[model samples]
Target: MGTLKAWMDYLNSINGKEHDSFFKPYKEGKWSKAAIISHMMFWDRFFYEERLPHMLKGETLVGITAEQVEEMNKKAEEYAHSGITLQEIIDEALKYRQMLLDKLQDEDLSRTFTIKDRKISLQEYVNGEIEHDEHHLKQLKAK
Candidate 1:
């Protein structure tokens, strides 16, 4: 479940669903599928474009505050509602994820990187993304 191939297969399984199914919130105060897609899309690009390259170069990542996280969530919600189709977001997210997998294809998962001086392996980071996606999947599937 930690491998890139596993993650891609999981994504492909769900990515072909109807767009309208992803447009509306499942319940009050919960995120719509569109917002979830937007959130994943944002993080996929962030990982591929910012974090992974820096990790490969052994550069430090400045700590992101709780407020910054809140802001990103707000931005994702706005993006989801700004008339962009859910399919577009899904496509871009998957593309970035593929880029990430490609970039890390021959890299050592056990190799460590520092984020705010705290060290972690690439496997740990990828697992975090899987956990995040699974959490949202559960929310979306809940009755």
Candidate 2:
């Protein structure tokens, strides 16, 4: 299966137990799995709404800075506890994923965005998403 297909299938299989368990951090002050998931969803929404439009318009893209990434994590964690249920997160994640997937034409995958002064292709970015998903999924299930 495609990376997104497999990754999203794993997400679709998450139950209440998994969702609740995801909130358990391996160490204090670290991100819980749900927070990580929320962060991913935020970016998925980001590209779905922001990056895709720029690419579609053939506009230049901007790179995300470390400060911005930190802030995004903070925002995601805040939202995770802001009364949005895990189910809601999952639902929104699916929608965001679909939004991007719908635009993933071969031409779209060839699109590039400027990040860190480098041109990053949509295909490269999507691969990074899979890598992110795998990293977090392992941490989430680690004993």
Candidate 3:
């Protein structure tokens, strides 16, 4: 519940910003708000739609490669500049979060997964995503 509350607060704070500004590019070489949104959306979607199901099925979760991480960043940049609306990205993130919340209630939080050579539980992974989101949000707000 605290996590959900924090997410709601974060969403509310972003809603206060201008729509155009929310998706505007950050300083050159940095991720724009749109890119950040896409990154969040991607990870959220991954955890709720892919990773969670894999874990539930007792499948081995392979580590992420450095190349894949780079690709993810590249895709985020593409998504940012793709002319998709910020609200659409936000909605996707919300849907992903809700899916996680729903699944978490019934799943074992301690279930572990291997990603990038590290072993992390479902709870830890989700918290990492929240942290990543907040870091990007700060970057977005500072721009």
Candidate 4:
């Protein structure tokens, strides 16, 4: 198992009780712990499943519109409240992450992709994913 695999396993260990604490709001009507997980899973799928393969094949990156981003966020929020189990979200995320890791070779790490009108390497993107996960995990722990 690689570092990514380890992280995925750690995420998979989270239970509903952990999710309840993780998703608890600082205030009412904000994103719950489940919503946060859904948001993360949404992006994991977007990047690994949708964007990464295109990027690896030298296809033009699809730019996200503000409306699309909003819609994704809204859908994520709904999914969070849909009574989906925390383990389900974790499993999906891990599967996607593993898919990404499998596709990424050492040389591919230096490959670049355009995001938000800026060019960033695959290594940068993977690092960003790890950082994003860590940040959310912190938020979950803080609740």
Best by lDDT: 1
Assess candidate 4 and give its TM-score to the true structure: 0.77
Evaluated with TM-score, which candidate comes out highest? Answer: 1
Candidate 4 lowest-lDDT run of ten: 15-24
Worst 10 residues of 3 by lDDT: 1-10
Q: Candidate 2 or 3, higher lDDT?
A: 2
TM-score of 3: 0.79
Model 1: how far residue 74 lies from native, Å: 1.2
- Candidate 2 lDDT by residue in tens digits, 29-140: 7777777778878988887787777866656778778998889889998887787788888877778887777777545576777765677787887888778777776766
Ranking by TM-score: 1, 2, 3, 4
Return the clash pairs for model 2, or none: none
lDDT of 2 at 63: 77
- TM of each candidate vs. truth: 0.86, 0.82, 0.79, 0.77
Is 1 or 3 the stronger prediction by TM-score?
A: 1
Model 4, 1-143: lDDT tens digits are 12455456656567434445544563476677767777877887788778888777655686889999899988987887787777777777677777767777544677887866788787787787778778767665553
